[model samples]
Target: MAKRRKKRKFILRRVIVVACLLVVGFFFAIKVLDLFGEGNSKSEESVKEESVTKEGFIEKIAPYAQELGQAYGVKPSIILSQAILESDFGQSKLAKKYKNLFGVKAYGNAPKVSLDTKEFVDEKWITIKGEFRVYATWNESMDDHTKLFVEGVDWNPELYKEVFTSKDYKEAAKAVQDAGYATDPDYAEKLIHVIEQYHLDKYDS
Candidate 1:
C-alpha cells in the first residue's frame, strides 16, 4: 500500500510539472504573437507615411488631372494644387480608402465615409464629424469634382465660375478663394505656391 501511494504521488508530481509547463508555454506564445503584431503594425504605419509626397503625387496624378482639366476647361495645375491641399497629396483617409481626392461633402445617393474634419465655420476652426463623399475610383472622384463645378449642389452652383474661366493657375487659385473654396484666407497663395513649386502648370499645356 505504501509503494502504491508513492507511485501515485510521483504521477501527481509529473502531472503538476506538465501543467505548469503548458501554462508557461501559453503565456510565451501570447507574448510572441503580440511582439509580431506590434512590429507589423509599425511597419504598416511607416509605409503609409512614406507612400506619397508632392513630387511623387504630381507625377502620379498629373495625367488624370490634365485629362479632366482639359475636359472641363479647368487649369490642370490649379486643379492638382487644389487636390493636393484638399486631399493632402492623396494620403488622406478619404483619398486612400475611399478614392475621394476633392473632399466633397457627401450628398445624393452616393456612399459615404464619416470622418472628423476641420473646417473654418463662422470665422473659427471647428472639428466636426462629417460624411465625406466616396467614389469607386480616383477617376470617378475627379469626374465628380468637375461635375460639382458644372452643376453646383445645395452648397452653391457655379461656385468657381471665375476659377473655371481663369487664364492661369494664379488667377484660378485666386478665383477659387474669391468663391470661398476654403476659409484659410491664404488658400490662393498656398495653391499658387504648390502650382509653381511642382511646375504643375506644365500639365495645362
Candidate 2:
C-alpha cells in the first residue's frame, strides 16, 4: 500500500510539471504576438507620417533626412542642406530637365535623357542624353539622395564618418570639406550658408 501511494504521488508531480510548462509556453506565445503587433503598428504609423505634407520645402524633406541619417549614420541636416543648395529646393534646371539632383553624369553609352549638351573633348557640343537617377516624385528624389550617400560603395565612409559624428551642422560640413569630398575650397562654407539660410538643421534633431 505504501509503494502504491508513492507511485500515485510521482504521477501527480509529473502531471503538475507538464501543466506548468504548458502555461509558461502559452504566456510566452502571447508576449511574442504582442511584440509583433506593436512593431506592425509602428511601421504603419511611419508610412502614414511620411505621406503627410507640411508647410515648407524643408519640412517636405524631413523624412528623407531621417532615413538618410539612419542609413549612413550621417546627420540628415547636412544632406538636406546640400540638396537645397544643389537643386535649389527642387527648382533647378537640371532637376526639372534630367532629374539629376546631384549633378551625376552618364558615361559609356548608358541610357540617358537628352538635355542641352556641352563639349567635353574639343568636339562640338552635341545634344547628349545625360544619365541621371530617375524618381517618380520629388520625395523619391530626396530619398534616393540620402540612399546614395549611405549605400554608395564608390564613396568612402571614412570621408564622412567624422562629420557624421558631430551633431552640429557647421562642424559636420567642415569635416566633410576637410575630408576632400568636394574639389571646391569653399564647399564647407557654401554648405553652412545654405543650412543657415534655410534653417535646414532643424530637421536633424
Candidate 3:
C-alpha cells in the first residue's frame, strides 16, 4: 500500500510540472506575437507619415520630372526645384486653380488668368497683377516649362539654350537665371538650395 501511494504521488508531481511548463510556453508565445504586431504597426505608421509629408510632394513630381528630363536633356532636379518654388508644392492659387505650376505668362490670346505676382526689380520686390497661362493638367504645365528651355523666347530662340547644354544641375540653375527665367536676384541660389536640401539631384541620372 505504501508503494502504491508513493507511485501515485510521483505521477501527480510529474503531471503538475508538465502543466506548469505548458503554461509558461503559452505566455511566451503570446509575448512574441505581441512584439511582432507592434513592429508591423510601427512600419505602417512610418509609411503613412511619408505619404503625407513634403517628401510626398517631391515623390509625386519626381516621376514626371524624370521623364521630362530624359526627353528634354534638362535636369530633373532643376525642374523639380523650380516646381516646388514656383508652385509652392502645388498649393499656390495658380497651381491649384489653373494647374500652372511655373507661373508661365500667357501671350497672343492663349488661355490665361490674371493673378497677383511678386517680382524683384531695381534691387527691390514689387507686386504686379499679371496674366499667367492656364493648363488642363500639371503635365501640360511641366511640358510647357521644358519647351521654354528648348524653344526659348520670341526675341531669342537660343535665349535658354545654355540651360539645355549645362553639364550639372548647379550650372543649369545658373544658366536659367543668366537667361532671365526669373527676375529674382537669388533665383539660382534658391534652386541650388532646394536641390541640395532634398537630395533632388539623385534623379539626374
lDDT of 3 by residue, 1-205 (tens): 9999999999999999999999999999999999999999999998888657668788888999999988889899999999989998888999989999988999989999999999998999999999999999999999999999889888999998888888999999999999998999999999999999889999998
TM-score of each: 0.70, 0.54, 0.75
- Please give the CA lDDT of all the candidate structures: 0.85, 0.68, 0.93
Ranking, lDDT, top scorer first: 3, 1, 2
> Which residue window of length 10 is worst by lDDT in model 3?
48-57
* Residue 60 in candidate 2, Cα distance off native in Å: 2.1
At residue 119, give the lDDT of candidate 2: 31
lDDT computed for candidate 1: 0.85
RMSDs, each prediction? 8.0, 18.7, 9.0
What is the TM-score ranking, best to worst?
Answer: 3, 1, 2
lDDT of 1 at 94: 92
Higher-ranked by TM-score: 2 or 3: 3
| Best candidate according to TM-score | 3
lDDT per residue, candidate 1, 24-49, as tens digits?
99999999999999999999988876
